[model samples]
Target: MELIRAIQLLKLNAVSTAWVDAVWDCEFTDAEPLDSTVEDEIKEDVKVFKKVYKQLLGFSKEDSTQSVWNVFGENCVSVKSLVAVLACFVLGAKAKSSSVEQRRHSLQAAAVYLLLLRIPGSVANKVFHQILFDSCLDIVLKCWPQSAGKKRKKETLKSSQGDGKSGKRPKPPKKVSEEMVIDEEDDEEEEEEVYFSAQDLLGMREDVCSLIQTLLKLLENFSLRDKPQSADSCVRLFTELTNLEPLVGELSFSEKRDVDKLQSLPELAYHGLWLLCSSSNHGEGNECRRRVFFTDCCTLFLMMRKERAKPCLLPPSQAVCNARDQAILFISQIVDEQTEATLPLLKILIQHICHQIVEKSEYRASGAQAVGRLVTKMPCQNYADFVKWLFNYSLNTRVAFRMFALDVAMVLLAQEEREADATLEPDLASYLSHRFLVRSVVYGRRSDVSPTVRAHAMHCLAQCLELPSHNATKWIHELFSSSSTAGSQTMMETGHSEQTLKRGETAQKTALTFRTIELTKHKSLAVTTRRSTDELPLAAA
Candidate 1:
């Protein structure tokens, strides 16, 4: 009766830590075994508790309405009460001698409770999240205790065996005096940590993963229907979790290679990617949030891709590539929506696109298209900043990456003289026509070691020369005169070299004439060609 009263008070938000602890103590410390009658009583209490929770939230067993969901953020339950309940649930889960089914029920109930409270989700919905997400993560942090306990027990047993082998037998001690000392030592040495098997860890992980996946799915469902504000809370929660430095370090464990042991880690990753994919499509108003999402997605994509390519282990089935594609698509969407990409974001996009271009990945074209579209639409200052950043970045990075950056620059430079409308700022035009840049690209074409890089640099230089601000005759002359610098031995024999220029010295002139005619023919048509967001292609199968 006392436990029931305490629980009722908790439902009314009468948060008292002492009362919560008392109730847990009384309920879990009952001396009698859980016979059918006691189990029936506990089940009835759960029913009553659930009913009271629903009632407090202005919901009913059969009632389902958005208005009812709105009550979640109304603070019907005080923060302290929510924390107390969740703490109690965590304690129950970790309780000594608790049945597996009981612990699972406790965790599941707590998860449902948290999910319900988050239904009125918003970016600022931290009241329930701090208690719930933090508490669940705390549970994960406690998982090592089981393994620790096993080690301690093994050590203690070994020590006892050593004592026995030494043949040291002491006189039996008096019951009241020496017995107390032994009892004290025994008590201290007893299992202070939770004792769980490998199966238990796997089960706990599955539960945690399922709870997170379900919560994200709920948010995704809300987002699909345009309820972004409701979904934003989940986004904020997940973003916070993912960005936590410790979480990744903990998940990337190499000690254990068992699939079941590490399966939950990948599952968490997949669901996180899914949430990112969904959020990217829905939230258009929050650029900062989207930027963070895409940035993390980029990092995750690289990690997942690298992990998948290792010959020893297969990546999570279908998920790595699917998530990667979704991330690329999201980048494309951001390019279409935002007026300009930040320098960091631009660099990441360039890096990712460059990899795709080099690998001939199906998504290569999509990434290239996104870069071109973003560059063309960016403000003149931003475009100039990006071009300068790319120039420096290419010089510092790998040769393959440098080629891609140059490809992006070439796409941006492939424009005719502005007629009446001036999108390119004056300083930017001057910067684009810098003599040093033109000469570096010319040098790259004539003498770069990698044929692919040279070919890309050649095309890039040609496009730069075609720009209205550039002196075409000077670049054309440089292109023709620099032919002798090309490696005759490497260029002549390699029939299928990705080299843009052929062996003959006359080929350079022909290439220049061909490029000039092509640029002139398409310059007018290219100016009017705008890529609509709807026409953005997906990753090719």
Candidate 2:
């Protein structure tokens, strides 16, 4: 009777402060090691609240009396409020339970109630993806042995030790008895057993993965509809979940040793990435939602980028890489036209392309291709910057990356010839000098050690020769002069050398490797700048 009266009093409260606090504090029981009788009492109280909540929903529909609605509304008897309260209830139940099975069952109950019920998706999604996810993540993070902080402190201590003078080695200890040795061995084995079991991390992974899968199903159900916001919500949840830094900071991993081993963490972000991308693809119909989705994904990529900087032995999560790939592909398809809204998107894509090119990820080729497509669509000013970036890369790194950068540059520079409407930005236009073009090509074709790079450099030179700019003819003259000068120098050196046979053979090979630009008139310069595939015939058709 007192429990029912207390529930009624909370319902009657009008102020947000009064009711929110009252309901939030309405846990089943505060006592630990709850007895059967206490559990039964708490369950009874929960049942009464559930019953009243249903009645309010039912009566509010049938009884359209404004007075009744106003009274119930004051008590905040909406679906969201109800879901929040029930989530609190389930979390409290799980926390208060001593048995692992009981806690799991409590969490399952929370999932079933929030997800399996025929509640409106808006209400259910908000609670399941946001509130429940956060609560579950908190639970999982707690399950981790709190050793991140201690590990950090240990690292700092080790680092600080290097700065101070080295201390003398301690004397060797005397041998202990066989019984003491056995006792120490037993303790070491016990610690190893606990570390290997990893029950907490396993249990947390199972529960969280289950919930994430359920949320993904809910997202799919809303896909193909005009639920752009729904898609946004799904992506937003993942963006928060996959990020570990904020969670680490909040949990203070620096101070604790709860995590048994540093490497024993579950693949939390890996599972969330695919879902985020697939769901976002389904929900990008609304313009506003699409923009927000892109922005949030960029943020998520940055967060993952930060995560990579932390020292870990494991390879990157495949899911993180896949998610980034999907984001690039998505941005490429959706942002068909360059606008102010997409400037940030283009910047991030370019950044990723540059990093991927240098890092040599499996997706580097795809990232480069995406950047290639983006360059053609970029605003004139941005395109100019991209051209300069490619130029810099080609000149700086004399490696395969430089080859790829030159290939991309070939496509960009040839865009003017391929499409008459294509115009160069002032930055790129002013820098298209005969000397700059000639110098870049001459170094690549003659100086680069790799045959493949030399081939690509030749292809780029061919494309440049076909360009219709005023400097094209001048570039041709300069290339011929440089090639002649190199050939003459090689002849003089070869003639004067004692080993004339070896020197003659080397000079012959050098002559064959020189930049061969054949000017043939075609309708337009259809230069095949793709060096990622099989080798092409050298003759410029």
lDDT of each: 0.42, 0.41
> Which run of 10 residues does model 1 get worst, by summed lDDT?
532-541
Q: Taking the tens digit of each residue's C-alpha lDDT, what string does model 2 give over 284-382?
A: 423333333333333323222111122111223655544444444445544553256455445544543443343233333444555666665576656
Over 1-541, each residue of candidate 1 has an lDDT whose tens digit, in order, gives 2323434433534345565455344542332232344334445554443443444333322254644334434535344344445445554554444555456545555554554554554324433434344444334323322335435755865665545556787444334322111111123344444456779656755565545654544444334224333343343344333322223222322212332333344335434444444345445544333334443433232332111121111132344444444444444444454434333344444433443343232233344445665455455565555565555444422454556555554544454322222766665664455443454433344445577667766766656655765554465555456563464333333322224333454244333322322223322111211210111011110
Local error of candidate 2 at residue 495 (angstroms) = 29
Please tell me which predicted candidate would have the highest lDDT against the true structure. Answer: 1
Error of 1 at 97 (Å): 16
TM-scores of all candidate predictions against the true structure:
0.41, 0.40
| Model 2 alpha-carbon miss at residue 65, Å | 10
